[model samples]
Target chain A: MFVRLSAALLAMAVLATAGSANAQSLTGSGKLLLTGGVSQIEGAAGGGLTPWAVIGGYGSARQIGANVYATDVNTTDFDIRSTGVLIGLYDRVELSYSRQAFNTQDVGTALGLGQNYTINQDTLGIKVKVLGDAVLDQDRWWPQVSVGAQFKKNDKAALVTALGARRGKDTDYYISATKLYLARGILLNGTLRSTRANQYGILGFGGMDDKRHTQFEGSAAWLINRKLAIGAEVRTKPDNLAIAKEGAAFDVFAAYAASKNISLTIAYADLGHVVTRRQTGLYASLQVGF
Target chain B: MTFIALALLLAAAPVPGQPGAATTPVIATDGKLFAEFGGREGLVKIVDDMFVNVDADPRINTFFEPAKREQTKARLVEQFCVVLGGGCTYTGKDMKAAHKNLGIQKADFNALVENLQKAMDKNGVPFSAQNKLLAALAPQHRDVVEKPAY
Candidate 1:
């Protein structure tokens, strides 16, 4: 599945660039550097793990921009690899898709499962900016707000059901507000999500029960310079999994926009209570955009 | 534990070889301080550079073309002088009155601001100094923007 998706994304990127004569000329001339956040875990334009209010890519108003990213997170007992593509339209709408493969390394054998068992999930997301511009409204009290939805489907449906999961597919809806304090060189984002997914659908959708709860995710970043940005994110989770206690997640990341076309991000993630115990790991991602 | 410590240390670490003592550039938030930096000459340079940028920016260039360039620049200088407490009273129209019918959108205002930033940069105004002036000018968005915030 990863191979197939990667092929499709690559093909689209080639096509978008090869036939780039018409709409490829982005003329809006957007704001300062690092204002457009990095891609999120689920392929949304945002922090590493959570979504922010800004759209993806460098395309300014009335322009189209595309981004491609591949991310890997290696933990004590697990390895998660995700790849995705995002498109930003007119700096108002965003569409993204990502495939995640959760490789339970030795932990699978320890849990009586086969060694290196993998759980895969596919996510499709769309977000629309409803109001405010984080960069333009720096002096005001208003913050940019956006609404988005993510549709996810897990591949290990039978195993997910056997583990007391609710279903194989579900959708999570969220509203986010992001603010960029240009003068202070700080960016803040807050989001409220209504979801039923367990372990972001890698462990399958929902938990033992049928109820969904609202979760909070927030991120803060400081633009140290035109090329460097450092941020921390915390995303709370719902405790629906009867199998294990699901705790909130935290990550501290540094992103370097090496150029307008490429950016690299490195982070230390503390994802609490996955499978059984805590998993702390290093995360690295590379994103290419036009 | 180690991650938190490392992040804190990175956050606290001084930015490598940049202007000002802090990671970001220094700015004079007050008129007296701004005067000490360069006063009228600095403001004039900033204004001149900003107009050059505005002239080049297609996003907001049309809005500026119909008006007399010199008169507008003079008014801006006067306004900036007063803003920085140069003791020059601005005799031009107030912000709301001056921009009432212009119907400036958030994007336009932001473009104008972007040009202003470039101008400040060209004149060697510290990032902090540019931000200070912008902070003082930010409130005028209420008068300049014809459209609602977005």
Candidate 2:
């Protein structure tokens, strides 16, 4: 149960970050509000946070922005680090890419996957706003929506497959909705995602199904002021490798919008053990755009 | 529910130190403007003249083409009222952000501003008051325009 909860939490954190990164801008709908900032969440949809229904960071048609970011995830057996770039176009559409490097530790020798094997994964993604500005139309019935996709390729797929994986490459699709109640300074966001990757390959893939997995994700943010935002998310994912149980995990985060071009995000994550204990860590991201 | 009631009360409360009460400025200013424009009956006449000027402007017509002109005119009245210190909230984008992405050229902006000036003149807004409002909006040009606006 702990492992399952931790996995769920990890997924939730990623999604939350993606949403913040993308929707940080006030342009809730249309192609005129993209920004160049990293989200507080990592590995979700936008540069840092989970996908938001809005098109870009808080900027509307009046500005342009972009971001470059890096992240490191430390585990007992291995450490994973990633670096990426995000670009916003006309405050309407976004393009992003990241490369992740996983370094195996003593656990690699014990498991025989390889002695200190290095695994690299590259991901590319795009997000487009579909409807409504949550900020401008706070009293309306419409919710802001966006559609996005990510393509990921694992560089050490041969080794991963040989270790018992069904597929080496995968793609994910997501539809996200974001709404901001400006009067109350509250923002709500949700995402429905479909993916084929197994457990983010923490325990390796191929134990169960290789088919696409359908997931539900949601988050809420309270804008305390123009600069500070506090939020949380709960995300559902598949426990394919028999490592963790299937369920939802929670993520709490804080973000600071330093300016139109820069922002910073930080979070504390708890990833429960698949077999025995829970794993918790600190996460941080910085995004800058022009 | 209580919040709604409070909002309504606040909206209706009289403004202080004018032809009416002395506690609320919104009501007083609204009354002043209403009287200056010849009261509720004259408001209709002024709206008609304003619409005539808006209809003659091609640059702003794109935003008006899809709508019922009468309805648009009503919203504009509310907007103008709110902007001119009538105490009504104007639920619209800040001028800079709204026009920034439209790639609105200087000619278009000048034409629209001129048309609005004409409407205000037609509505009999004092020249000083019109110039004050235009001055307040002038700084917005930096954000609303991305290219040389000439």
Candidate 3:
């Protein structure tokens, strides 16, 4: 499955041609490198775990940009994989969709669901840039802010229902703000989210209480150069299920922007209690955009 | 919740006014580097380097051809000095009036920005100081980018 996924992801990356990149400046004028951020797991432009306020792609205000990404996270107890496509319109709006596969490697057998049972989810996201410029306004106190939404649907709805989740589908709303200090080569992003997912919607959303909770996610990165950035991210999760206590997630990561169109991110993530305890892992993602 | 608040606070920490990568200075902190940048010497050097690239820039070279190189350099130094908070005051034409009829498109503006970055890097200007100047100059894009994105 990993091999197949790898092939598909590579094909997506290769499919984006340089000819299709319209502008002479693939990224906007005055925008620093890696300012687009990396593609998040849910297909938003951001850190590995949390979405940032920057719009996805290298498009300036008058141009259009698109992105495609694939991710694989191998942990001690599970293997989580995802692939997605995203498009940024005029550097103001972003639309994204991602498919996630959560493979309960040994845990599936322990739960009597055979070996390597996989839970599939599809997420659709929309974000609109509503505020200041993260890059150009660095001299002032302004931060770029955006409002977004992600609607997620579980493939195996019946199985998720049996696992004590109230629903197999739900929507999450978020508002994120991002600021940059180019002089210091630092970037900061903070997001407020409203969600009720159980283990990131692998087991589904809104467990016993069936209540929505507000959460916070944030990321900070130090830009090493035009092509490299190192950072850390933290994402809060809702605990609504009686079966297991959901814990917050965090990761330490680095991203390399190989070019205007390609980026690779790697992180060490601690997604506490994904049905099991302390699911620490190496998270890797490849993104291609223009 | 406290963690989130803490993280936001950390991120919002005020950016310090440091000179550049050149000094790692403790209280060589007299804002000397910025003052130097504002001085006639540093401003002249920066404009000299910038115009050299402008003459070679394919996208915007023709725009500079009609103007006298030395006059342009002198005016730029004055403008930069004023922007950098130097004691000197600019006597040049207003930004929009000066840039008018130059056919400055976004591509042209972008090319000039790249050239400026190169010049800054070559001048040993600290990255932070360069940004401070750029931030002041960025608003001029509204006046300079006469055409749509190019």
Best by DockQ: 3
lDDT of 2 by residue, A1-290 (tens): 22443454345335534645564432222221122224423233332336675544433353233455666656444566666655454445766666667777565676675787677777777878655444433334456566777777888777666655666777777777676654355678777777655545433444477776767777777666446677776666666655435334555777776755566777654544432344445656665544
Global CA lDDT of candidate 2, please? 0.54
**For model 3 chain A, where is the 10-residue window of minimal lDDT?**
A23-32
lDDT of 1 by residue, A15-121 (tens): 65575566444434354456678889999999999999899877666556777889999987899998998888778898899989999988889887789989989
| TM-score of chain A, every prediction, order shown | 0.93, 0.76, 0.90
Best by TM-score: 3
Model 1: residues with Cα > 4 Å off, grouped in runs: A1-28, A109-115, B1-29, B32-37, B51-70, B91-112, B136-150
How much of the true A–B contact set does each candidate keep? 0.16, 0.00, 0.21
Collision pairs in model 3: none
Candidate 1, clashing residue pairs?
A: A132-B150, B27-B129
- lDDT for each residue of candidate 2 in B17-123, tens digit (9 for 90 to 100): 22311111122354664455444444456566756776776545565544567765565555555544655555655555555567754334444555665666777
Location of the lowest summed lDDT over 10 successive residues in candidate 2 chain A = A28-37
Comparing to the true complex, what docking class would candidate 2 get? incorrect
My TM-score estimates for the predictions, one after another, are 0.79, 0.57, 0.79
DockQ of each: 0.13, 0.03, 0.21
lDDT pick, better of 1 and 3: 1
- Per-candidate local distance difference test: 0.78, 0.54, 0.76
